[model samples]
Target: MDLFDRLQEQIGTVRLPLFAVTVTAAAQVNTPLIAILHWHGFRRATPLVLPGVEIPSRAVPGSAIQLDAPWHSFETVDAMLLDAAWQSGAWDVERVEQRGCNVIGASAAETLACRQAFGDYGEDMVRDPQLLGDETDRDGLMQLAARRGYVRWLFRPVKGGLWRTLDEPDDTLEVDGGRQPPCPVSPVPRRPGGSGRTVYRLGKVHRILLPR
Candidate 1:
């Protein structure tokens, strides 16, 4: 069976907590902003303790941190983000969304369930030996116990840059006003039984606070 099918099976039988936090910005300033937020305790305030796991001092400056906190709930993360934004006066943040389902199981089973649920996001984090810190790799089993939480941020400088019609090119020019090469856009199959219109999933956009 494929990963998603396995996930559906595990999710159906297990009783553990699985949550994800996604943050989107109007422009591509999410990386630095998130770093600043983490510096100010948005990342450290979580009480979810992983015995041997060492949380990064700061999230990777450019990349987002994917699901790595199984002990935390969606609501808990949502509140933390809001509080951080408020305290840091990061009015540029547009929206924050957290979602998770309950799937109970033993520690091992819980880890497997989260690993499957988070998919590639979890895999990338788990496979990184440096990210795993002092944890021993028992045939890659250590990853099973790691948290499957992640933070994703998106930003678009132009308000309607992403709203172009299906046939339009998907590339954006360089900030220096140079004629940048166009990037390829992948085509997605239309959903069955619905209108034949193409759909775009922009995810969610939220405002985040940055340190001055």
Candidate 2:
């Protein structure tokens, strides 16, 4: 049987209510937690953003965010989370840790399922280290996912102060909707071989246009 089918069979008929799945890090590091949750069809109804944590970092500094989901059962939720993490090349058995808890209160079954799933998946991930891609690429993909709304933008404070959103204005654009173009042009000086036209080179192609 497939992994999902096997997990379902092993979990039996146990069901749990809504719960929160949280992942903590020692420093501000990018992971695919949200993307994985979304891939598993889980919605992050409420996200708790904790800023200015005690994590130390020289380049980038930020706080950890706890994402909460109201899943029907821990077995299915854990299975999906594990599968998504594996597929997205984000599961790190060593550096990253995850936990789940009942949203309203605590439940034995839910907690057990969480621990069991973590142990099982964590081992599998370690056995197959190829599941993870390059750290740089993974971080880039996470940023792209956040920009596309596939995941919430959790970290704002970084090495550069705050991460800018896609909708934020760029420095090149002027308030009046007009600014100096990126290309540089020299006025056509009156000379023997000059056609009195401004010349600009664009990536290997030379073009002459009327000066506005």
Candidate 3:
């Protein structure tokens, strides 16, 4: 069984607010979603920090997402939370420290290298700067996030969303309006008799962001 299928058997349904992560060219940081998050009463900026970048709704000196590579070693559970924190910038170190977030005093230099080098997924969508730790292990982390209900929003740098409008990017993927795009990753299968759950072909590897 694939990772996605295995997760489906383990965890039934995830009840959490959709956590989204978005990275675009520096020019387009303040997109509609940022505004929308603000509109939804998310006054804090800590939730918007990702690896190598911090997307604060309102910039605050201390509220930063510190992307220390050594501190963030690659383990399935840690990787999931790291990616979620990297993607959504929602993790409060002070709050989640009880849940295994300990600062090991590593350098954010590795994190900076990733962002400066690729800055999210590069062309062909194969190489993401953030996925550098352990390519083989990412799937496990992805699955774990689903099992724990942390895989809320897997927003990539695609055709639309807040980034597109803000960047006015030329390489945006085109759509026919009727069909949705194919998922970036292959899906895991589902187990029989799963309640409140339907097996996704991509197996919920990426968080789905429904535009409201």
Ranking by TM-score: 1, 3, 2
Off by over 4 Å in 2: 1-59, 90-212
Top candidate (TM-score): 1
**Which residue pairs show collisions in model 2?**
none
Candidate 3 accuracy as TM-score? 0.19
Choose 1 or 3, whichever is better by lDDT.
1
Comparing 2 with 3 on lDDT, the higher-scoring candidate is: 2
- Name the 10 consecutive residues with the lowest summed lDDT in model 2: 151-160
**lDDT tens readout by residue for model 1, 68-103:** 223233333334343333222221223321121122
Best by lDDT: 1
| Candidate 2 TM-score versus the reference | 0.18
Q: Identify the runs in model 3 with alpha carbons over 4 angstroms from their true place.
A: 1-99, 102-160, 167-172, 175-179, 187-212
Clashes of 2: 0
Which candidate, 2 or 3, has the higher TM-score?
3
For 65-104, candidate 3 gives per-residue lDDT tens digits of: 2122222111232233333232222212111111111125
